[model samples]
Target: MDDEQQDGRAVRVERDTMGEVEVPADRYWGAQTQRSLEHFDIGRDTFVWGRPVVRGLGLLKKAAAQANHDLDLLPDEIADAVVQAADEVARGELDDHFPLVVFQTGSGTQSNMNTNEVVANRAVEILGGELGSKDPVHPNDHVNRSQSSNDTFPTAVHVAVALELAERLQPAVDGLVLALEAKAEEFADVVKVGRTHLQDATPVTLGQEVGAWSGQLREAWGDVRHAGDRVLQLAIGGTAVGTGLNAPADFGPTVARHLADETGLAFRQADNLFVQLAAHDGLVAVSSSLRTLAGGLMKLANDVRWLASGPRTGIGELRIPENEPGSSIMPGKVNPTQSEAMTMVVTRVFGNDATVGFAGTQGNFQLNVFTPVMAHGVLESIRLLADACRSFTEHCVVGLEADTVRIAEHLEDDLMLVTALAPHIGYDKAAAIAKQAHRDGSTLREAALASGDVTDEDYDRWVDPAAMTRPG
Candidate 1:
C-alpha cells in the first residue's frame, strides 16, 4: 500500500486484482469500494435505502467468521476481531463505511466487497495494524471466507426482507387491524345507506362496512406473513454458483444457524441452492403479497374518504379527524389527508411490485444479476407500507367518528327501502312506489301509503333501517 495526500486530507493506495486505487484514509472501505464509488455514481440510493441491508451484511459476515472458525478454517484471533468489527457494522455503528450505491454490479459484488473491506479494515484496526494493510485478516480470505457475492448478497437480501417484515410491517398491520376492529364494534348500531356503483342500494350498519375493511386487512396480513416465511431460506454457502465450490459441505447451514441465533428469526439454508441463487421467487412472492395489501389499503382509504366526504353536501356519514387544512385557498376546509397519503403509498407499492416481478425474471444462467435492485424494491415496499399503515391508523382510523344525524338522514331518505315491502306487497308495486318517491321527491313511507298498496302499520314494520342491516 502507498500513502499520499489529496484535497488537504490523507489518502492511501489500496490494490485489487485490477490495480491500485486511491481511497480516503479516513474511510474504512478499500480499493473495490473506491472503484465502485467512482464508477457507479448512478443514483442517490445507497445502503440507506434500507439500512437493514447493511445490518444484514454485517450479520452475515459475522456469522461467516464464526462458521469458518468452527470449521477450523480460520485462526481464532482473526475470527474474533472480524466478529467484533462485524458486530459494529450490524449495529449501524459504522454505516458511513458502506457508501456503495444500489446501482452497482447486478450481482451486488461491489456491496459485498464494500462490507468485506470495511470489516477487514476495522478488524485490522482492532488488531493494532495500519488501516490499508491486509495484514492479519484479508477481506476475502477471512472476512468473506466460504462465500461469494452471488450467494451472500442474496442471503443478505433474504435476511433484510425477513427481518423488516417481522419487526416493522407485521406490527404496523396488526395495529391498523386492531384500530379497524375497534371502530367496527363501536359503530355496530349506526345504520346507514349502502352503495353499489356509487348509487344507494340498501341499508347496512356502519359497523358491517368497517368490519369488511378489517376482514380484508386480516386476509392481506395473512398473505404477507406467509410470503415472508419463504424469505427465511438463505442462499449462503453456494460459493460462486450453486455447487458450493469453495465452501465446505456444511458451511451454508452453519452460517444460517448462526444468523438465526443472532437475529431471532427462523433462518435456514435453502433446500436447493441453485434455485436460491438463480431466482428470487421468495422476494417476488413477498412483493406480490405487498401488492395485494396495497390494493386492500387503497380500497379502505377510498371508502373512508368517501364516507367522510363532507359535513354538509357529501355523504357526511363518517367524520374523520381534521388534522390539517385541505387546501391553500379554501379556508376551514379539511381533507382526508391521511387517506390521500396512504393511497399514494399504495401506488408506489404497486410500482415496486411490478419492478420486483420483472426483476425476478431476469435471472440468467446460474445466477440472478438483479439482486441489488430487487432488494431495494422489496425493502422499500415493506418500509413504505409499514409507515403508511401506522400513520393512517394514528391520524385517521383511530379518531374516526359516526355522524349519526347524517347517517339517519341518508338511511331515511333512501328509496331502496321499498325492497322490504316487495316480499309483502309485490315487486312491481314496490318498484312503482320507489320510482314514484324518487320522481316526486317524496318519502318511501308517503309514496307507499299514498299508493294504498300497504297499510301504515305494515309500512312502519317493513322498512326498518336497523333491521335491514342484517338478514331477516
Candidate 2:
C-alpha cells in the first residue's frame, strides 16, 4: 500500500511529478491535496468555502459523465460510478474530505483537485477498490475529463449564488415585506408627526410610513433577482483558458442542460466564456444589490429605533417589542435589540460588498484569481441578510405597536402644524403664527387662536391635520 511506520504512526508516501510526500493513511486525498493543506494555513476557516463550490462541482461532474457517456467518451460502468460518487458529494456526504481554506490558490485549483480526489477515491471504493487508488476512475482522466479549474470554479460561483438567492434570500425578503405590510394595516389609523432633516414637518399616518419600508424591500428583491439572472450564465465549457482544450465541442452545452435539469434552475452556458471567466462582474452586481438592500435595512432599522427611542423623554411614537432586559444596572430599560441586530447585519453586508468589489477586480487575463473570496463574500451576505430579515420580521415588525396617545400628543404639539394655515391665512400670517407659538411657549393651536388671524370656525375648517395628510 506504499505505507511505512514512522514514530509509531503509519504514513503513506504518495508520489507526484514533483516528488514523494507523506500522506495520512486514512485520508482520501493524494499528494497534491496534502501539499495544499501544508502550504495554505493562512486562516482557520476550514473547508467552508468549498461547500457550495464542491456541491456545484459534484453537479458539474455528474453532468459531464452523462454528457461524455452519451458522446461515447466515458464507458457506462465508470460513468455510473462517477455519477453515484458525485451525487454523494453534492449531498454533502464528504464535506470533511475538503479541508482547504478559502484563501488558498487564486483559481481554487487546489479546491477543485480536492473535490476531484475525493470523488475519485469514493468512486474507486464503490468499484470494490481501495481509497486513493486512482484506479478505474482516475481524478483527471475520468471525473474531470472535459473540465478545467478556470471554467468549473467560475461556474460553481454562478450556481451557488443563483441557487442561494432564489432558495433562501428571496423568501426571507418576501417574509419581511409581508410582515411590514401587516404592520402597515395594523397602524393605519394612527397619525404621527412626520420629520424631515430631523425637524418636525407635517402629519402622516403610521401606515404610510411602514408601507414606505415595505416598498424599499420590494425594490431590493427585484434588484437581487436581476443580479441573480446574470449569475445563471455559466462559463463551464470554456475549459482552461476559454479554449475548450481536449474537450468536445458540444461539451459545454450538454453539461449545461444537465446542470439545469439537476438544479431545476435555468442555467445556460455563457455567450462568451472569455468575458465570463476573465471578470467577476456578475458577483459584483450581486454584491451591489446586497449593498443596496443593506442600505434600505439600515434606514428602516434607524427609523424604528428613533421612533421607539424612550419611554419617558425621546420620540416614543412606537413601542418596540422588548425581547430582553436592556441594562444590568438600570431598571425597566428595554432597547430596540432587533433593530440593533439588523443594523449590525447591514454594516457587515457593506463590508462584504466592498470586499467583493475589490476581489472582482483582481482578475488577470482569462481567469479571476479572487474567486473563493468573492464566493465567500456573496454567500456570507446572503446568509446573514436572510437570517436578519427573518429575525427582524419576527422580533420587531410583527409585534410592533403604535403609541397612539404619544403620537397624537406629538402631532398636537408640533410647530410645523402651522403649515396647514399657509394656503388659507397666507404664508406671512402662518410664519407669524409659528413664531408666536415658539416665542410664547404655546401650542400651535393656542398661538393661532391668540393671534386673532381667523375665526374659530375658520381655524377648525382649515387646520384639519388628517385632511392635510391626504392628496389634495
Candidate 3:
C-alpha cells in the first residue's frame, strides 16, 4: 500500500500485481474527489437503496468519458466502450442484475461503485468476456476520471427529479386543472346562496364559486411547472469544491452537452461553483413551490368535502362518487374518501417541503451530505401528491352533482330572505318578521304575505333561492 513516487514522498496507495488493490477506507478517491467515500454514506434503505443512484451514476460516468472525445484526450476505442456502457444504463439493462446491499448507503459511493461494476461488466460483455475485469476502459480512470461525487451526485439528483417530475407531476397537475375547469362550466347556470360568516348574505351563481376554485388551481399549475423548470439548472461541472481541479479543461461543458442530447434534458452547468457545491437551495426552493400548490389543494379539497357532506341531513350541494359504504350501521352511507386522500397527500407534500427546507439549512459549508434522503423525500412527495390529485379528480370532483332537492328544501324556509326585505321594510320590521316566522310556525313568505309587506308575485320573484344566490 505504501510506494515512493518520483518525489520520494511515500504515497499510502495499495497496489499489487492486479493494480492499485488497496483503497483508503476513509477516502479512497484519488486527489480528484473531495471527502470521497467517507463523505457520502449517511443512511440506507432496502427498497430504494441503490437503483436510481447507481444507474444515474453510471450514466454520468459514461457521459464524462465522452468529454475526452471532445477534448481529444482519449482514444476512439475507449470512448466507444464508455458510450456503450452508458447506453446500457440509459436503457435500464442493468437494473435487475445487481442486488442492492448495505454498501449502497445514502453516501452514494457504494451505489456509484455498483453502477461502475454493472457498466464495466456490461461493457466487457460487449467486448466478449466475463465481468469484473476492469479491462478495455476502467470505470474509475476512464469512465469516471474527470468527476467527483461532489458534482456527480447533485447532477444526477437534479436530472432524476426533473425527468421524473416531467413524466409524472406536470401531467397530473394539468389533469386537475382540466377537472376544475369542467366544474366551472357545468355549474355556470346553477344559482345558489352565497354565505358570509356561515349565514346567507347574498346571491351568487354556483358557477362563479367554482370558477374561483379553477383559477386557484390554474395558478397552482403554473407554480408547479415553474418549479420543475428550476430543476433544469444542474451542478455537474463543479468538481470537488467547484474549482474544476483535475478535470479536463473543456470536459465539463462537453459532457453536459452530451448528456443533454442523450437524456433530452435542458441541463446547464452551475453559474456559481461555490454555491452549487455548498448549498441545496435549488431543491429547497422547488419543493417550497410544490408545498404551496399542495396547500392550495388541501384547502380546496377540504372545502369540496364539506360542501358535499350529506344528501339528507346537511348542506348537500355536491355529491362525490361512492366507492364504499361510509358507515357500517347506517344504510346507503358513503364518505368523500377521494377528497380525504387528497388532503392527506397534500399534507405529506407540505411535510416533504419542510424536510427539504430543513436539510438545506443543515448543509454547513462545502457540501450537503443529506442530499440522498432529501431528494428521496421530495420526489416521493411529488409522486404521491400527483397520483392523489389524479385520483381525486377522477373519483370525486368529476362525478360530483349538485343536490337540487336539498337546495329547494332549504329555500322553503325563506328566513334568510328577510335580509333582502330590510331595504324595502326597515331592519327592525325585517327582524321582527323573521322572529315571528321562527316562533309562529309559518314560512317567512306566509308571515310577510299576512303582514301585507309583499304579494305572491313579489314573493316568488324576489324570494326564490336561485335569484337570491346569484352573484351581483
Question: Which number leads on lDDT?
Answer: 1
lDDT of 1 at 466: 84
Q: Rate the local accuracy (lDDT) of all candidates.
A: 0.93, 0.87, 0.69
Q: Please write out the lDDT profile of model 1 over residues 1-472, one tens digit for every residue.
A: 5779988888999998998899998999999999999999998699865899999999999999999999999999999999999999999999988888889999999999999999999999999999888888899989988999999999998999999999999999999999999999999988889999999988888999999999999999899999999999999988788999999998999999999999899999999999999999999999999999999999999999999997788888889998988889999999999999999999999999999999999999898898899899999999999999999999999999999998888888999988899999889999999999999999999999999988899988888888888788
lDDT tens digits by residue: candidate 3, 420-446: 777777788778888889899899888
Candidate 3 TM-score, C-alpha based: 0.81
Report the candidate with higher lDDT, 1 versus 3: 1
Give the 10-residue window scoring lowest on summed lDDT in candidate 1: 42-51
| Most accurate candidate by TM-score | 1
TM-score of every prediction relative to native? 0.98, 0.97, 0.81
Shift of residue 16 alpha carbon in model 1, Å: 0.9
TM-score of 1: 0.98
Off by over 4 Å in 1: none
Local distance difference test, candidate 3: 0.69
Q: Score candidate 1 by lDDT.
A: 0.93
Instruction: Indicate the residue-level lDDT of 78 in model 2.
Output: 94
